[model samples]
Target: MTVLNNTLTFRRGLTLKNRVIMSPMTTKMSFFDGVVTQDELNYYSLRSGEVGAVITAAANVQDGGKGWEGELSVASDKFIPSLSRLASTIKRNGTKAILQLFHAGRMTDSKVLRGVQPVSASAIAAERPDAETPRELTEDEIYHLIEDFKKATERAIKAGFDGVELHGANTYVIQQFFSPHSNRREDQWGGSLEKRFNFINQLVDGVISVVDNSNVQNFIIGYRFSPEEYEEPGIKMADTIYLVDKLADKELDYLHISLGDFKRVSVSEEYKEKSIMQYVHEKINGRLPLIGVGDVRTKEDAENTLANAELVAVGRSLIIDPHWTSKVLEGKEDTIRRVLADQDREELMIGNGMVEFLDFMMPERLR
Candidate 1:
């Protein structure tokens, strides 16, 4: 087997057939009521069988956590039937399925929240030009949010997913709490660096406790995080190193970093020379598997990425080539289409919303 064809066993002993995991991309294909639509199922089914695993688009863990239109939800048991369809569709191709759990926090627009003020660790606004300052979450609310995540885990367990990936990356609630720029709480939820991690600590502990008692074999838990941010008082490589150290010791199945380029250099001046992936990998130090992701488009790219971490996640590449892993394994790498074309949309079963996203991302080709 090629490096990409290798089976990967998580800490919980849940194994995947290959190293090519499909990175979660927002499909915007779910129903407005937070139900998983047929479009969502069809989309996942197309790409599910070929990759080692398919991580579903971020599903809000609670009602207030929804971030985008058509985002999936595991917030309530009422949504379990739809969630089960999502999990089963992905697993039908014999691939391991991991559901991503998320909360938008201050990143959400009030309009999206139906006029509700978005909540965050502090009332700080994002640096975006039109970003609104969010309402600070009260202590009771913070604890409730922890339960919210645990509840989502329960839903995932009931839905029959292989695992759940905490959406700690991007500018979501988890990142907001971890980021100094966004978190200004003087209470237990935020303040000093260690206190900032308190939320995640309790969250992981809570989720793990549930998974432990579930009696399901190989129900793994993974975390995805952005290593650094551009905002002042934001997370930097040094801070990420600290966070990784703590997370690694927690017996997580894997640590997945969010990046646009696997080889991109650090935003922090002191860590300028080394790539962000390298910095994170060094911090992990093989304590747990690390899934390296970015613009890993070609077989060579995947192999090179494996040099830094244990696995590679193909996002846009998978968006354009649903059978990317299958092609690589079958020595049909030369047949892969690297760019999107207008004509290819129909056969790929692309939904109207997904087509719009592709159009936005690759306008020239889609046109």
Candidate 2:
């Protein structure tokens, strides 16, 4: 068996049966009201149980922060029951379930927010096509948002999730507060990099406080982040290193560096020599577990990724074949489907929304 079958134990005392983790992906299978549907349950039920853990798609912590249609939400206690169903579905076969939480911030439009203006650290617009200039959050609103995140963690615990992953990556609200392109305020939430870290700092602290008080034991909290942004004056590798250094000292379980390719070198010119994962691995220095992910599709890929990270996360490959981990573990890797066939859609439990998204985003992989 490959190193992917090795077990991993988080600092908080939680253990995974293996090192392979299923990366979070948006399925868009939930109902319009953010309720979990059977389709979504079926989707997870089929894909889970083989991986050590599965981080679910980004779920909004506040109603106003909804990122897309049919996204999951833990914004209110009322969602606990529906989310419980999701947690149980993913927990089948002893696999850990982590609910990813985030706010779209300016990444969302008023249309997604139902005519309400999106909010961010500042009034800046995201560096994307037709991005709306979001309303700057008031101090009170920021505090309320932190509380909302804490409440979301409470909901996750009550729903029986093994943990919650703070979706601080992908230019979501947490990253927006840290990005120079998005956060242009002079207040405590912006200005210097240290100040910009206040939101996430408080967020981690809040989530930890909730977990500490809860009856559940070994509930993990992971942070995911994009290392750099392409926009001028955006997040650079140095900024991310600083953030990593700070996070290493926190009560975090792991740091997941979001990358399109696990072996990709730095995006910024100064740090172009080594892969981004290499840089982060060096900086983290084993203080907290690191999860490496990007296009990992085979046993060799997962083994190579384990070189730099304590855990290897597989995303699209899991979409192509939910039994990927089982097949690889059973020495049946040769039988694993590397490409998606038209007939594999329903058989693979890929949601209609996800199929359309995959077609638009990565058509080369689908036949």
Candidate 3:
């Protein structure tokens, strides 16, 4: 029971209430123009009170970075008012809100972003054929992208979010550079792990400068990382430890960790069989608050993870049951739904609202 009582408050100057965080789960319910929809608002609001912090679904920083059709975007000012409204709604329910800024890198389908060639650390394609072959980022282009992240952070702050989380996990642009298999560049932003992490470091520095870290109470900057590159064999716990040590110097507020990549999607069975969070917790050793996200389904599981890690992040489990946190806290774990192991991807429909909304927002040819 002490483990359940142990609340991990993520704080800069102020504090979030508890250790339960709603991990960033992509809900492609954004209007074609990037504004959040009513359905999106309802979805987040449902989970707000039960969790300590709510990290909004991935919002692309640049037009080229856009991966899916209905993903939220902060590429322009016109989208801010609606986004602000969504953030306000989440905060009204007593949860700290953070926006996860993302870039798909080569994982983006060319057909989606107006035939734009995806960009990455180097001219490498993701292991999947659906992913486009990315153009190697030029020195000028890399700097421009960094500024794009800075501007997005400013927009997130204006939109009433408490802080921002860099989407560096799951074979995204940042992770692509961090992993040796994808990043084969010879420049300053490539080669060694330290050089590979330089882009993320620069992005963080730019964001911290704009947001005024001290003034923004409860200001949290989280980075999501995957130590085991599901696509390649080389990435290990040691690599992740090195990455965390470097990021700690940058003053990252939290480290959200999970396993697998776009190439090797982690299924529920694999998650239950392995202690991914424990491995990550051992590596972190309390340097920064560790956020453990995977297949955390039961309250007991969440409590166990919290005993070892700073926070427990629930993803698909919450999608299946929005009141999952409250149910677990109240010892009603039996009522919580578990995502089926053999469930078809199409049948799962976690972000179904986006699919329904996209039909009315954009025509099929454009979508």
**Which one is best on lDDT?**
2
- Residue 30, model 3: lDDT of 83
Per-residue error (Å), model 3, residue 287: 2.1
Model 1: lDDT of residue 360: 59
Worst 10 residues of 1 by lDDT: 358-367
Q: What's the lDDT for all of these models? A: 0.89, 0.91, 0.74
**Across residues 1-367, which tens digit of lDDT does each residue of candidate 2 receive?**
5788788888778899999889988889888878999999999999888999999999999999998998998889889999999999999887999999999999999998889999999999988899999999999999999999999999999899999999999999999999999999898999998999999899899899899888889899999999999998799999999999999899999999898789989868889998899899999999999999988988888888888999999988888889999999999989998888878888888877787768754678757
**Regions of candidate 3 where Cα sits further than 4 Å from its true position:** 260-276, 337-367
C-alpha RMSD for every candidate: 1.3, 1.0, 6.2
Residue 144 lDDT, candidate 2, scale 0-100: 97
- Among the numbered candidates, top TM-score falls to 2
lDDT of 2 at 306: 80
lDDT of 3 by residue, 184-292 (tens): 9888998887898788788878877776643556666888887666566345556776777777666678888764211122333444434656655666777788877
Tens digits of per-residue lDDT, candidate 1, 172-243, equal 999999999999988888899999999999998888898988888998999999998999989989889999
TM-score of each: 0.97, 0.98, 0.85
lDDT of 2: 0.91
What is the TM-score (0 to 1) of candidate 2?
0.98
In order of listing, the candidates' clash counts read 0, 0, 0
